[model samples]
Target chain A: MEASTSRLERDYRRVLRLLPAGYRRQWGDDMVGALLDAEQSAAAASAADEGPERQAEERDIALLQRPPLREVAGVAALAVRLHLASPSTAGATAAARLRGDAVRRVALVGLLAAAGPALLSAVTGLYWPVPPELEALGHTRVDALASALLALVAVAAFALFVTGRHRTASVLAVFAVVPDLRHPLETLASAWRVSPGTLLGAACWLLVLLAPLVALLAWRSDAPRPSRRWLLALPVVAALGWVPWLLWRATGALVAPDAAGSLALGAAACAVVALRRSDASWMRTAAVLAAVGGLGSLGQLSLLGYPPGLERDLGWTALGTVLLAAAVGVVAGVTGRRWSAQAAPTAVTAPDRSASDASA
Target chain B: MALTEPAVLVLTALVGETRHGYALIAGVEELSEGRTRLSVGTLYGLLDRLSSEGLIALDREERHQGRTRRYYRLTDDGAAALEAEAQRLAHLARAASARLRTARAV
Candidate 1:
């Protein structure tokens, strides 16, 4: 009985080891005691009800030197709960006031950058000689309406982003990505006979859709709102994004699908600015998001046999974003102390105390 | 703050008197009619959060048979909060009963 009890104790400790060191130090022995107490009571009840043979079998199973999967899962859930719980440290406090900061400037810039594709698509989709089947939805009219909606959503996102409503802008941006996301996916999936060009186009479109979403996530609710003077850049964005790009792209045989990459570039640039600021922990998160996005897009691109033009187009612009993301990611990783140690939430210089330090 | 079911159960477990971790777990199981069983890690995490939020306080500690035992009880604030939650549940129950009575009459 003593040997079985010791073996069970070892197994319980092994399971309890899943908790953070600080937490274990505070309540480890007490917790073990509680567990043993419960187990002993359960054993007593089972012994009373069941036969001796069942009790011996149960003791053998319990002493088998293994913690149950339920116990392991419970510990994992506890870890998650511990991670999500707010720390007592002041450094980890939420920054809700960044709502009215320079994040708006970046979001506005991204909106303007994104506006180009819609304008280009709307205009060029008009003059381009699409096949009879391509014109099924009244050709240019339906195309124009879709572009207008995309541009509208982008503008609305910019407005909300600048006005200190990051979450609302994020939601709007998510809606905006739907059309972009659907277009390429549908184009690629429309037929059993898929072409290399269509695959590249789909990848490109997917990248475009993901850029704004990643940007909005990076900027999030923590970014400061933009300055009013920065609002003057709207006219430039309008002219460059909508007017000229549309005219230029529409006039060509090939449509320049550049807006999503441009938006991602803008997003990465914003992340850089966020990282340089004094209150930049959230900015660090933004940088990491951009890095993950860049890597993910690259992974998607790697899976496809991209055409030569697309290979060149994606390699430079998309890869440029990745490089920028890497730069920020490396800096954030190297310099950030709180990000790593926050999992085991305790002061770095805190003196170790025994569990006997508890107050009644 | 709106208490989760587990938080409510923990509060209920401590209502009678200060209880150590094992006793509290047993009390919660008994009170909840054996429907709820909190693991040690989960219970401690909840207790930490509750203590941090000032809903519960450490009452006493004792060493029994080479094992350390820490006891906890609800604070005044916790008692008041629990009372408020009980009233809210009662109100909801009364409303449900009224609806059932109306249905039966129809």
Candidate 2:
């Protein structure tokens, strides 16, 4: 029994590692004490519910030596919530930690926002053929390198974020965006001379360019580090983000063919998957990134105008952009709130629930 | 404000006296008739929220048998919240009873 108890305790400690360092520092002991108390209570209750001779023999076995999977999943979800919600510092200096947390949060979000469109642009060279003035900047090696870096850094940053490298992801995201900031700013400065549509598009681009900096300042500390299993489906998701654009380019480049219905369908599919997941953080993030990326492309479309005579293509693209973005928002919000509600009481009765609802 | 089931149980546990994490776990089980069992992770999340909302406060900390036990108590805001919830539930119970009585008469 002593050996078994110690093993259980060790398992709990490993599970605790999913949480941020600062959170662990502050509440780790209390958390351990509560878990042990719960284990003890559960063991006693199970023993009382069983026959005496059987109880004496089975008490040790009843309390699992391994941490239950659902419990661990719930705790993982809590870790994400705490990471997003808690502002505990974990850097060498107070200011640095705050700054680091702030920058990382923004850069992460900015990274997500930029990633999909950036990938699509890189894959298809789907640059908006701007006015003759803008076209003068032509495709140069420097431009290609910047695009490559942007795409690589965004994916790497997202991969890092999903894999629990908080600061490194942030640094990568900031590094990716800083070089491109000047162009958006310069574009925005000429707002007075540009068309209204172009001005709106530039403003949106400026926001996209500036988001990471804002995110950097906005986050306090204790950014989220959810489970790495969240990234297991990254390739599929990355494909989903770009494949539609690819299909459009290949099949109907002149028309910018309708991906809106497909985008909505994809969002609905993501929502279905997310609904099945108790945490669904990964799904939510993926949906948000997809939506933001679509918006980015829409902004580019505005800058590109009607693309010769493809008025319908621009209209369809714009519609898909709005609907997909809205679909992600609606689905993410509903799923997030529902999961949050499920996280509470369900965590307590998890063992029984897991046996009944294996999908949970 | 409407509190979640765990938040309500936590407030009920801390309504009269201070209790530490282990004790609160026991208190909540008792309060909820054993239908709800809060995991440690859930408890702390609730505590974090309740504390930030000024509904609960840390009373003190103590070392017992090599374990640190930090005691928490319900604040005035917590007591008020609990009372309101109690009234709401009581009102619900009363209405159900009255409807049942009318149905019996019918």
Candidate 3:
């Protein structure tokens, strides 16, 4: 019985190692004790309802049993909460607030970037004169109307998100991603007939569509809502993001327009942070944008096989810009977070003497 | 803050008593009418959070059968919070019953 019990203890201790060293140091023994007691009680209860032979067999089985999967999952959940400095974690107010701010900014800026081109597309489709030749190719009034509505959903997602109607905005944002998925799905469906470059394009397209949704995890109940003043930036973003890219495309096909626009957006965000009081929040936002842009640039690789022309040139140009942005963004973000950690005042509470004595 | 179901059960179990980890788990299971079985990790996570929030505290500790056991108790704040939540639940139950009676009558 003693040997079996010791072996079980060793197994549990191994599992407990998944917890942080600090956490283990504080509560490891107590946890072990609790786990052992619970197991023993459960085993005893089961034995009570069994014959002597069955009871002996069950005891052997119980002695060899490991901690349950649910218990392991619960520990993992605690680890995530501790690592993220989630709001419920105690005495990590500064760290939690900083993390919350950074995540919130990423979501807001991502939606803003998405909203810009969408709004422009909707407006131009509604107001711009369709050339006779283009109309002859099969463009119809219904097609234009559908396009406009799609864009408007994206724009509404951004507007409602900034104004704090997050659940509705989330639904709208999900709907907005549907149109972007068409080309990607088409590419992926043709995988048997297409090059690996096309596959990369499909993956990148999916990533771009999903980035804002994934970043939406920032919207905890305690997350601060973006101020309404953010709405004023919409027009500016539309003008800056689309005008230069459109003009450049019109003159001569440059880099992938979306890639260049995303790189420029990331730069603009970084510049805003640089010009103001620098903080971890903006740096993290830049990091997220640059990471997304860098990954998105992979889509351009699909064009490299094109007969050496504008498409090929675009592939190379976009790839370089994104790579550079990602490298710089990562470095700056890590450094800024470290500096912020050093500067923030950490609160320290004395350990409970009674609890310590109990453990001893 | 609104308590999660498991948290509410734990708090209710701790009311008017100091209980060790296993005892608290049993107490919570009884309180929830066997509907909730809190694993060791989950119970500890709740205990850690509740302790930090000042709603619960380490009341004492003891050694049982060569293993150390720590006991937790509800603070005044915890009792007050639990009371408020219970009243809110009561109000909701009452309102629901009243509406059900009206609908049945119709």
Local distance difference test, per candidate? Answer: 0.59, 0.61, 0.72
Winner by DockQ: 3
Among all windows of ten consecutive residues in candidate 2 chain A, which has the lowest summed lDDT?
A: A346-355
Docking class of 2: incorrect
Tell me the spans in candidate 1 whose CA falls farther than 4 Å from its real position.
A1-18, A36-48, A51-60, A63-66, A87-277, A300-307, A330-360, B63-67
After aligning candidate 1 to the native by TM-score, how far in Å is the CA of A147 from where it should be?
14
> Compared with the true structure, what per-residue lDDT tens digits does model 1 show for residues A1-360?
134356666777777676556566667778777776666566655676687777766655545445556556766656443332222311121221122122333345556565544444444555656658867856665665665656667666656666677678778877876765777778678746777755765765676566445445335322345555544555555555453346547753222325544544454655566556533544544553454445544533442355656455545555555565566566655545444344333342112222212232
10 residues in a row with least lDDT, candidate 3 chain A: A349-358
Of 2 and 3, the candidate ranking higher by TM-score? 3
Per-residue lDDT for B63 in model 1?
Answer: 88
Question: Candidate 3 lDDT (Cα, whole model)?
Answer: 0.72
Write candidate 2's Cα lDDT for A50-118 as tens digits. 777666555455445676675587577566554444344211223233334433433454544456445
By DockQ rank, best first, the candidates go 3, 1, 2
Candidate 3 per-residue lDDT, tens place, A150-258, comes to 8989899999998889889988988888777898889888899988877987888777667767777667544557799889988887776566577667866565457
DockQ, each predicted model: 0.32, 0.12, 0.42
Candidate 2 per-residue lDDT, tens place, B1-106, comes to: 5677888899898878989988998999999999887777777767766775667777788875466778888877778889999899899999999999999999
